[model samples]
Target: MAQALAAAGARVLVVEPNAPHRLPGLLGAAAPPPEGQGQVAPGIWGLFLDPEIAMAAYLRSQVRVRAIAERMVRSKIYQRFVAAAPGLKELIVLGKVMMVYRGRHQVAGVGGFDQVILDAPATGHGVQLLRVPRLTLDTFGESPLTREARRVQEMLQAESTFVDVVTLAEEMPVNEALELEKTTRDLLDFQVGSLIVNGLCPPIGEAAAAWDPGELRADPRIAGAHYAATWCDARRRMQQQHLRRARAATRAPLECLPFVFSADEREVVAHLAAQLRATGASRREAC
Candidate 1:
């Protein structure tokens, strides 16, 4: 999605807040700079942030105590503190995200990014990570922490900021997507943008949908072909069922990306990018 947005002439920054960053390798870029952005392409950049690094950076700027900040980050007690605190880690990571989002962080010669796409963890953590600001406000009451939380909460609920839930057209992922969508809307009050359904099996024509590989199973010459076709047809049918369920359940618009069969990551991204670009164009026309 980042590549697609960048290709469409938007300055895009993809932030991987999760550990063991994979976005950089996926985008064919070298490891991101420890504190700033790394260029993925002409219009696309990537940033890898974690709680400790972000907290140290924050303390340096805000407290003007660089030594203490570094020492605290390196300490076992500080690590446990972040782990024990409910929303501290999430808040620190999100603060870095906001900095990039608001263009406080810059890429020299190119200025700040037009869009900051966070590659937040998807296994329920993404939803919880987003809910941190609201949770902080509820627990802390009126304080400096709550004040900062309020600011982040307002930005999250703003019309300009949207959370796009990406999932596959499978039972488990679709279920998670639906739950995540509702939580973001009802609890977080954030606009649920498109429910991007990835890895969709392309539609089989009516004839193929009704194909009976049973007849070809008896023929030795094409038995393998028959088996392959049968499996693909079955997979496609399953995808359709989930797709229907997703469309029926979701309030967000569904954007489907075809399953790209390729070993090269660039080719896969390019294929999806073309589809996404077209989807964006159609949406603009409709609006």
Candidate 2:
């Protein structure tokens, strides 16, 4: 999605929070500065946010004493405080993200990234991350943290904010996706732009999908081939069932990405991006 948006002329920023960052490896681009943005593609930039680095930066921005920012972040007491706080780490990380988002808005088409795509953690951690702003606002009185949280919350709940929920056509992933969609609507009140069902098998005809390799299993020569076909057909059937379930479960647009058979990660991304573009999914957002 980041590359696709960049292709459409939007300057994109991908936030890599998880380390040994996967974005750098997937894009086959050099890792960006730990605290700064670097070009990943023509218009795409990457920002890998080390938690400690983000925390130190956040502290520096908040504290009047610039000299003590680094010292404070490195202190054991600060670490203990962070541990004690429920969503402090997530909030600090989001603080940097909102800084980028705000910076983009400030300079709309002039410079900097136009879109910020956060490569946040899986559903559980992601929910926690998204919940930090509300949590902060609820837990504290008026303070710098609360002020920052307000901005983050505003950005998150903004109509332009699109939470693209990616899932596989399987029970567990579908369940997680449904849970996320429900939470986003009912609890967080965020817009779920799309429900992306990924890695779907190519459609087989009705006869083929229902075909059985009953007699072919006895033949040695074509047994493996038939078995493979049968397995793929079974998978397609299962995928269809889950797809129906997912469609029935959410009103959000459900998009599907076919399973690509390739060792090249770039090929996979390019293929998926093309699929997304073909489906007219060109809307820009802080995904």
Candidate 3:
């Protein structure tokens, strides 16, 4: 999706908050030159959001005191404090995200980004992350950080910000997605923009069913092929059943992404992006 948006001429920055899923190491291995931000593909850039780096960068941007910010970041006191704080780290991570979303960065220049996609934490952690700012405001009253937290909270609740939930067409995940949607709406009052049902199997059940298995079973060469088709058809039917249940559960715009048979991550992203564009979910203009 980020790739497609970038391809469409949007200034795309993919933010990976989860340390493990960060692309820098993978991209560096593929193409040398280690950096905070690297071009993962044509027009698409990826940034690994190390909390300390983000906090330092954020401080430098706000205070215009790079040396002080750098020193503060390296200080054991600051590190321990940040580590001990319940949601301070998450808040800083999101602050960096808001900065990017607003197109404000000390090193990257002061132009706005057309699109900023966050590979946010899983549903439960994500909800807590979103709630931190509000919680901070309630607890801390009106400090600088709390003020910034309020701003982040406002941005989150703003009409421009849209949250899209991606889930597999399975009972557990679908139920979880629905719970997440309801919980987000109840707590944050943020309605999900869309429910993306991923890895949907193609409708091959009818075609497989129509084939005369008896004729193919007699031929040893095609027997395996027939069995594989039948298995695939069963999977497809199961997927369709889950799809129906997902649709019935929510009134939000639902989009189904077909399972892409590709080993390459780029190919999968490109395929999903195309599907998003086709569904009119890829809005070119930045909010």
Candidate 4:
């Protein structure tokens, strides 16, 4: 997202523990666009912020984030952020992205430009990450960390920050998404941001016939794995349905990203960027 947003003319600073991968393909599949390429292209710079450990790591890293910001702040491409993006809705996801790395338990470093879009890890660890603020508040009651947790918790509670929980469109993913969303609402009082129902098979306009010619029809291939290709359309439709139901069950509205067949490096990055850019949720809510 940092690379993609930078491509769209934003000063994007990505804070990693060590050196950046230098390309999206390493993380998934996108290639970074040219630097200082004008509003036609945004500037993306990376900073190392790992050594931070535990809730204490959340301590304002302004001294560190400031240095990187100073370098890119001069770029004309970055000036776009200074203006009022009347179209930009304030994004509502305050992520306590307690991501574990190098076998470390708590998030070693915490940072994002104006908005920290944490592509959080899987369901198992995601819970701990989101709960850091609350947990830290409980453990270290009135200390600086507690104060930090309070600030974090306030952001989480405010409309500005949502404890976002994402999942694939499958059953297990759906179950996890629902659990996380409700848990966030109940425990943290952070309204779940839009439920991101990822991995959805997009609507196949002409391929709708795979369902049936009339009201209802059964395909024998559906029951047999040997004819998997024959029933793929049916499975795709089922996937879509599952995604919808899961989103409907959550406090956050559902936002779906089409299932892309292109996993190629450059293609993956471009596609994800396109998907993010195209999401009405981002545009509608105002960030």
* Cα shift from native, residue 123, model 4 (Å): 2.4
User: What TM-score should be assigned to candidate 1?
Assistant: 0.88
Give each model a TM-score: 0.88, 0.88, 0.85, 0.59
* Per-residue alpha-carbon lDDT of candidate 4 for residues 1-287, written as tens digits (9 for 90 to 100): 65557656655544332124344343342443232111112354433332222112232332267656555445455445423322111111122322221112222232233443444446655556557676655655476445645665665566655556667878877887788777778865667777776666644532544434342235454434323434556667678778668745765656666667774665666687677766643533311
lDDT by residue (tens digit), candidate 1, 143-257: 7667767777777877778888889989999999999999988877899877888997765434554666677668875676656666777888888899899989988878888
Name the lDDT value of residue 185 in candidate 3: 78
Candidates' RMSD to native = 2.9, 3.7, 3.9, 13.1
Query: Model 4: clashing residue pairs?
Result: 6-42, 29-265, 88-286, 88-287, 89-286, 89-287, 90-286, 92-162, 93-162, 94-162
**Candidate 2, 1-287: lDDT as tens digits:** 88777777877888877577777667667665434556666777777767767776777777888668768878899989888877877887887778777873222233466677887789998888999999999988999899989999998988778888889999889999999999988898889888889999885544554566677768886677666666788888898899889988876878888988798998898888777776764433211
Instruction: List model 3 lDDT by residue over 225-255, tens digit each.
Output: 7777778788888887888898888756787
lDDT: the better of candidates 2 and 4: 2
- Ranking, lDDT, top scorer first: 2, 1, 3, 4
Deviation in Å, model 3, residue 29 alpha carbon? 9.3
Q: Largest lDDT belongs to which candidate?
A: 2
Residue 271 error, candidate 1, Å: 0.7
Q: Is candidate 3 or candidate 4 better by TM-score?
A: 3
Clashes of each: 0, 0, 0, 10
